[model samples]
Target: MRPTGPLATIRNRAAAVAYPVFYRLPRGLRRWLVRRVAPTYTVGAVVLLYDIDQAGDRTGQLLLLRQPGNRGWSLPAGLLDRGERPIDGAARELAEETGVELTTGQLTPATPNAVIHHHGRWVDVVFEAQAPATETTLRVDGAEVHDAAWHPLADLPPLSRATARLLAHYGISSPHTPLDPQPTSGQPDQPGPA
Candidate 1:
């Protein structure tokens, strides 16, 4: 039987009241509860905008943003809205975070969907596009992104794990290497006093 009139109104009101409370819980708990209640999964997209320098040995520079909340440097990314296509979501997130508008046709798939498991399982669709090296002006949304800059494929700051993995998948190595673990002196390693 269809819920009509007061019954429907009561159900709607109950959901409205419950949703905020549910959202306030820690992300892990919220996802756990949601999974128990329904089949819940999230889809996201990350956009890697590259500028190919035809004159500079045909090198490419990739755009990255320093996101707020210590998320580290990442490509512009966000969760897709319901009923939205992955390409469309990529375009939307790119425009929203970087103020760079792109048509859906311009983006090419960078990798197969990357499944990330954390508090919630996420399937991230990655996309990349080539932009003019000199023409594009990048403006970051201050609330989410603190800064935006383009780095050559060989030089990059500390990257978020997902971003690092993406670059590794593409076989691109960043110039920012970790300090060597070996001591400069050729001495036997000694353990600290317990």
Candidate 2:
């Protein structure tokens, strides 16, 4: 076989531990290694909260949070807390960003995606959630989020490119608004998935 060495000894000992045998090394270590190698494994989540109208019609509007950095517009999202359930994190983020309390049923895990750089490197576990069909007053914290609103689906201004892709996958569309035609940026303009 190979020559015995300190590194080899540590590796052999690590392999004997329950963590290594059962779940492999702890996920934190694995993620740390991944981040060190790729620098893109920093994880977070985005919650899409759609407000429905009385007729059971999805109003083609979604709750968005205006963050301190991207002070104009963005989907409600945040970094996952240690040991936090993804659904809980999503709901918490929705409430924290938009001050709307949504039950767990209103949230579901979405596909994982990556953002190369917005403020820094990040990976996102996006989720879709339905806001209750009732109107709730929004109280935004001016530090983290200065504004929160239900934006018409068809009229989203420039948001993160990654979020735009997620919207397309969900077949969401903005209701036709009477506002003047705005020039389309380089990104996709199709309504969200049906």
Candidate 3:
């Protein structure tokens, strides 16, 4: 039998608050429900940063891509090459998407946890960085990315929810308005793959 003490009660409460409502079901059912909520997923690594020189007092720009697959704006991100380290993958993605080499000293893990998706299959390990705001040029891969640009923190085009959450962690807010006390939880207008 399970322990029935104050500790157990607190544990139960914490579990309820941290997980979905259906977590109380049988193990198999609970797992099935959770999987059903976020079925398709793949892993990727990402980089974030601000260029201090060219990007003055404004919050640093996030590197973004207009990809053919999603045909929408997203963080400068890509899937990890098999057997690659997360940080290495992040740096590789940064270079591939923007032509900016993220030296070992410049990369940091923003989120090690998997970025889940109920709609698509993409799990990304995000990295954060801050660099001098210089006029860095971009050379994008047309097959994967049609366009690349530095988006001011305030005026991001519709992007992924996971990408937005990562930005919020750095104290940035919506580009369309002044900073709100709470970050937005709603979806942006970009359409996902059909």
Candidate 4:
């Protein structure tokens, strides 16, 4: 049974006081404290799905998803649940985000583990798989993914930095040129008042 009423109130009050002090510490110190308190780590996987067109001389296209609120597109990815294997997590995230399902054996590691610091440290495993030449439909969760599409190897939409790096690592060249820096006012460049 769960605690409630006065007991819950007491627990909440304790947490309210403890969390403020905990957050004030430096990130390294806070991570250390959390490690001492409990075993915790963030791990995730990114999946790259390539579509091959057998009829079109087996040309390759890459799948990318546009996330809501994010300017650049990214591969389907998500964090692993407690005790989940990286390969399993990759397959699961791919299915959840893009409705494309794959067995673990079908997925292959594309890069060494990548560690990134965003809200906190994250370790990501990258995987790649080829979609059947006949497969064409793609489905995305409306809330998290605004759009999903496959682009030819030489032609891709604006991509997130990580996606661009991954493509380069795989020896795939992006056809989209980088955009020029825009002014803060969100307008075309203009000379100062004459």
Best-fitting candidate, scored by TM-score: 1
Prediction-by-prediction clash tally? 0, 10, 12, 0
For each candidate, give its TM-score against the true structure: 0.65, 0.60, 0.59, 0.63
Which model is ahead, 2 or 3, in terms of TM-score? Answer: 2
lDDT of 2 by residue, 44-104 (tens): 7678777877776687888866666552466888778988876787788878877788787
Which of 3 and 4 is ahead in lDDT? Answer: 4
Reference-based lDDT, each prediction: 0.71, 0.63, 0.64, 0.71
Off by over 4 Å in 3: 1-41, 54-59, 111-122, 160-162, 165-194
Model 1: worst 10 consecutive residues (lDDT sum): 185-194
Tens digit of per-residue lDDT, candidate 3, span 112-137: 44444433445567677766545677
Best-to-worst TM-score order = 1, 4, 2, 3
Q: Candidate 1, 49: how far from true, in Å? A: 0.9
* Candidate 1 C-alpha lDDT tens digits along 1-194: 87889989999999999999989999999988877988555788888788866553335688888886544477888888989998999999989988899999988988654534333345667888877657788888688888888888777877765565555546665555332232344211221100
Candidate 4, 72-101: lDDT as tens digits: 777888888889998999999998988888
